[model samples]
Target chain A: MSQFVMPSLGADMEDGTLVEQLVAPGDPVQRGDVIAAVETQKGAIEIEAFEDGFLDRWLVPLGAKVPVGTPLAMIRTGDPPATPDIPQPKDPAVPPPPPETPQPAEPDLPPAVPEDPPLAPEPPAPPPEKMGTSHRQRVTPAARRRAAQTGFDLSALGGDRVISLDDVPSAPTADAPKPLSAMRQAIAAAMARSKREIPHYYLSDTIDLTAAEAFIASRNADLPPDARLLIAVLFIRATARAAQSFPEFNGYFEEEHFSPSAAAHVGMAINLRGGGLVAPALLDANEGNLETLMMRLRDLVMRVRKGRFKARELAEPTITVTSLGDRGVAGITGVIFPPQVAIVGIGTPGWQPMVIDGQLVARRVANITLAADHRVSDGHRGARFLRSIIDHLQQPEAL
Target chain B: MNDKDIRALMIRQLGQIAPDVPFDTVDPDADLRDEFDIDSMDFLTLITALGKELGLSMPETDYDQMRSFVGLQRYLSSHVT
Candidate 1:
């Protein structure tokens, strides 16, 4: 028996609206079968089933948006015609199904926080303009000065005697921090969960990208503007190459077991407009050349922005590669999105002074960081994985 | 086409390429990339849209000349007619 859960498209994607159901509850699902269309900020994506089974029952209804890892349906294994796309892990070892018990509406999630928490009735404090004058005697001289500078709402202050400078926050709390969108709330929850549950260990490597830069210029020189490749494609390809070698870093961690993926399914993290981000998989990242990868990247990003992508592209990412992409940030430390054990963060590349061949010279370089789950791979192996990426990047022509 | 209408055409493409960035604050002389946080994919999409709209062939070698609004306008002005 297997539980069909909502795949984590990105660490940030918390929930998706179930817009359409492709398969009925009783349908026999082949591996990689499209079961439903989920509406994310990236728009509607058809989600696929990773396991082959007799679709037992629908735990979630159409139009219901649920958190990632929530069991949408239960799949009964064995006695089904095998339409093999992915090999089964436990076929001969299939034991009798556990005694039937009802699954929850959602699992591994705390009670949903109301979009807007109940507000206290009209702030028991004095009126706005009245505070500066009437409460002027109650506030300390320094506090008054500080509050004025920060535009802090003096009316919100309470208690008998006086407010101190320490009481005045540097920022104006009077102006409420913009309420996070539903997607933002989901991102916050997912990140908090990743930090709490995953024993994340990080390592960063500064690699000279001089060779990659030259390779890019030479390649783009004769091509059309529409066909030119960017440095990011190299980063994604290198990450895929590294994950191909370091299989431990390229699979989901669930139920206290670590299963290595045969091929690297690289998640290309795309930042959505306004806010939030989604990292959908680019299947078989290691198989393509730089030009091929660039074309694939272009098509994926274009579709994602338009809000149309296939479900397998959203679900099957075993490892994710996130790039700052010329934003010019020095480096980034990523959080391990469960159950994927590893994430590769590519920072902005810039020319910097470095010693090479016993001489100080300027070299194009970037700092790449790896955030991996320690439960699956140690920092030592993680270092080796990052090293492979760095080396692959140094030889951009080969990749 | 007049420069103003051409600017609008380019902006229309940018609006599709990066739907979030505000063109009101954009510096015409500054690189579109720096002004709009436009990356390679956005850059490609922009060229593709403008090329399709104006029926111009922009080779990769000429991309540097089209990095800014003033430069792009000059390039398009010379090439379009």
Candidate 2:
């Protein structure tokens, strides 16, 4: 028998809602068959089978949400169906026999006359014996008193039904109500863990965006509506390049080991207006040109904003970049979105005075704050990474 | 503000914080933080925008009570009145 469980579609997808079941029990299924549709943080995705067999049972029903690796269905290869035998009821007309025939009033016992003993016993119909009911089972003294005072029927309320003194429910108190959505709960857990476990170190620098801004404007003038450049795209591309320069930043932390990756998958923290955040990855971002990066970023932002992103998009990001320029934030330190070693926070663009060779000149500036896990990368390496990103942003034509 | 007015304000505030969020698909009673991924910064931005628009001082703790649209509407209605 083969088990069809919800596969780990991505590293970050821990659980999913069984949105729909495409096949039913007793159905013969083949390899690559779409058995069910599951919804993750990203969106609805179909789950497929890996081998051919007869689907024996549907362990999880439609609308039943389950964790990743939970068995959703089972399949058996060329197995015969087993039939269960049914039991017939006995005739109700026949009456059951008398349990034991009154156990034949024990033989060899003699009957005695009651006249001799009755006289002495009668002398003391001992003043009506006081009913001293010592509780045999364990119960609270308070409960006993309450039962005595209120005449609460002890027989009806006692035994296993009565909670122990230590197990009694306490008085009700108000608790902060929490949201029930699994996705939101998971996000809270991840963020809380990230904030708590990751030892963060921040490095901030002002990038001269004069040339980049002009380049973006000129490019936007000739581009279509969907292909226009946003400051975030440039930030994403630069961050990706920076990650390549400092591979230590693009990696996941495991038990006593820092596994640095070769690929530069950038997770962009896209803000949703109502009240949450989603960081979707722009995969192979370092290898993409400005146009491709811009297009992919545009598509991702749009899809994320509309809540149409797939589960795959939220996983395996080597690094992350969150821009607050649109919301008018000049600069803010972002917490390292964990497992990933670094996050780049982009501030609103403005003009700042800087020295060029021997003369002071005003230039367009944007503060970029890089928050890295200190355990994985140090301050010197972080500075170098930031400088590389600044270099890329300054030289837009080369990016 | 009335309930309708509060909803409109929330939708507008949402747009400002997350220009890409789909307002029409959201449940008014759904937690803004949970459903839309609004972070603390976004929450602050929304409160600031709403404070400026309503000309009222709203406290940070007030956000805790304003989870859903109905909840926010009720809060605004009670406090504004």
lDDT of 2 by residue, A117-205 (tens): 22211122222434774444455765544333333444554455553433433211122122234445446557777788888999998
Give the C-alpha interface root-mean-square deviation per candidate.
2.2, 14.7
The C-alpha lDDT values of all candidates are 0.78, 0.69
> For model 1, what is the C-alpha lDDT against the true structure?
0.78
Evaluate fnat for each of the predicted models and list the values in order: 0.56, 0.06
Interface RMSD of 2: 14.7
Question: For residues A1-399, could you state the per-residue lDDT of candidate 1 as single tens digits?
Answer: 788888876554667766777776557889888887887755688778887878866667666767788887778777753443433334343333344332222234443444553432343343445544543437777777656654677657775567888888954344333344555565666678788899999999898999999999898776766778888888888988888889989998878899999888898888876667778888888885778888898889988877788867876789888888876699988877667889998888888999999999999988899999989989999999999999998898899
In terms of TM-score, the best-performing candidate is 1
Q: Which stretches of candidate 1 lie over 4 Å from their true place?
A: A1-16, A21-36, A48-179, B55-57
Cα deviation of B2, candidate 2, in Å: 31
In model 2 chain A, which range of ten residues has the least summed lDDT?
A102-111
Model 1 chain A: which ten-residue window has the lowest total lDDT?
A97-106
